[model samples]
Target: MTVAAISWSAANARRMERQFLLNPAKPGQAGPGEVVDAMLAAHAQVMSAAELSVGLRMDGATRLDVRDALWGEEPSLVKTYGPRGTIHFLPVSELPMWTGALSAVPGGPSPFKAGDRLTPSQTDEIVGAIGEALDGACLTIDELSDEVVARTGPWAGDLVLPAFQGMWPRWRSVMHVAGHRGVLCFAPNRGRKVTYTRPSAAGSEEPPLSAEVAAGRLVRRFLYAYGPATSPEFAKWAAAPARWAGEVFASLASAGEIEAVEMEGVPSSWVVAGDTEFPAEPVRGVRLLPYFDAYVIASHPRERLFPGRAYERALAGGQAGNFPVLLVDGIVAGVWHQRRSGRRITVTVEPLGSLNAGQERELEGQAERVGEVLEGWAELVVGPVAVGAHA
Candidate 1:
């Protein structure tokens, strides 16, 4: 059947969830850490560095183990590629193609465009100086800036700081491009320090794919990983231009990679892999999805994924800043937070609507799991903590 025919019924959503959310089995695995690493590489979202660490913990993976398995051997590879402008733990085989696609897309607005002004040439020099300083050493952004000022004479003192003040936007663009070129990659951070490394010779010599091809490949990957999505969803999630997003979907359709699907009540057309199909029932459990989790942040038209009234509360502040939420039966039922007092770790669940006994128990269980991954010895407490209603 064509994509337009298959509706994203509750069954379809659950099937996608099982494939991408639940950890895969690895029989006769070598190390616990390695097995966890593979699971994360395949499923976890690494779009934001902080999100990567948090997602692992939520998925029953520990911080130390994640670092040991994914970051221990080749520190540089971790930082090089992934979705959004962040570093995801992608399969080594998919690294080259993914990075190439992301780099071809033009970056979003730079925060530096506001007050801190620098000509394009000056910005180039600033980046060049930072790169030179980080030639062989892994330094934090602060350290890199310090080194740039120390070596660049007068430009380093005041001009560099202001010029570089709002530079993350610009630097991120360069990072995207350089990441595609296999020049720099994401590594573990020591506090605010940004640990980076040069890409391997093999990664460096690889040629980038054309923009159209890269976009198509990326869309396909997203569909396979987070399928039954729409062009707008793909566009928002990948940060690709709308026109490019449409083209990618069209190209995928041409290649038989995606088929259109219709939501029962929604009017817009959705796309999923040609082979994509969901089960007949929904998984009965509550899952604590971390902030900016792929499942939550994969698209802008999130109303389909969440209840209508609860949207404003979950996304309390605004679209750009959404609080961490609890997903019950593929719908956002409430928001959750962790409070640590001395040795006790208290997980407070604030449901937007009244929850039944089963849902409450499920939330408690999920909260306990979160506690286990975060603090090994801390006491776990799960229940409602009164908080003001959110808009």
Candidate 2:
């Protein structure tokens, strides 16, 4: 089919608006769950960063509000192993879609050797035990380990899987898979230690959609938020095989769920069949994004999002989200860092080029907004950042 073409700048502008970076929800009007739904999933490898990621997208949201949404009596979000097998904050309403989509990803071989890895039968037993153990109860890793070992066997608890500084129990390797299977999820932190529980506790146990249905939903969602993108980019973002992603995209296109698009200087891409809309002007604003922000991580044509100096300053190798980025009009322009003391937070920005006085003031306001999301007073400083990526 003949595809319509779009400029990279136009694509970026549309994506920024979809991601809530261009025009976020009004203060006190929207909740963290809405932001989570927009981004597909908010990375939670760094919990504080995840909170800011969701909070910043909602004009008046605070860290406490994010916390409440996750752990309150009627929680609206579930912290779990999301895409790429990493911790993420998923909207509770979409748990079934997330579980089905994530669990269907083709897994590679285990890193552990024969002796260290759990046998297929053992793995099944452990997965079952995890669901049973976590049902209606929150347990720390150690506590869960003990329960799993007792329910399964000593081999389930054997310390053989090599980890940083130490070896992990054999069953721990399947923990993420269990989460994808909808049997495990994170609970509120117990003191300083993280705890796990079953997602069933947060809501009724709804069955996950079939793999095909789930994959279709996920691909359309990705396109809605970051489209005019390619199968390979979606593969990278979802950690699914490139071939598998291509097949999924082809199926969606064939079914008329999506249509191909031509991006000048970019390979073939697609978007929701009738969803082609771009802003009259490029997105304009200075925004501060926390570490691993979904926009920086998921947006495609890497060079387009992190143009020129931002490629060197904000990214580690070709990967994004290692450094908190400063975006000028939807494109990365610099990097930034924050240091908090008591109720005050210091924001230090390192822009690639000189900013006009108005831009500088806008940046200061962006920094102050960052502090507000974190529930602190922010002081902005425009200068060099001393730290390196992911520091």
Identify the leading candidate in terms of lDDT: 2
Which stretch of 10 consecutive residues in model 2 shows the poorest summed lDDT? Answer: 22-31
lDDT (C-alpha) at residue 321 in model 1: 25
- For candidate 1, lDDT tens digit of each residue in 261-371? 666644445445545456666645566765555456653346656667567667755452255677776677777666666546676777767778997776666766665
Per-residue CA lDDT of candidate 2, range 44-104, in tens? 9998899999988887778998999999988888999999899999998899898899888
What are the root-mean-square deviations of the candidates from the true structure over C-alphas? 5.1, 1.3
Candidate 2 lDDT at 376 equals 95
TM-score against native, each model: 0.74, 0.97
Runs in model 2 lying further than 4 Å from the true structure: 27-29
CA-RMSD of model 2: 1.3
Segments in model 1 whose C-alpha atoms lie over 4 Å from true places? 1-4, 11-60, 74-77, 80-91, 108-136, 146-177, 190-192, 201-210, 265-273, 299-301, 317-321, 377-391
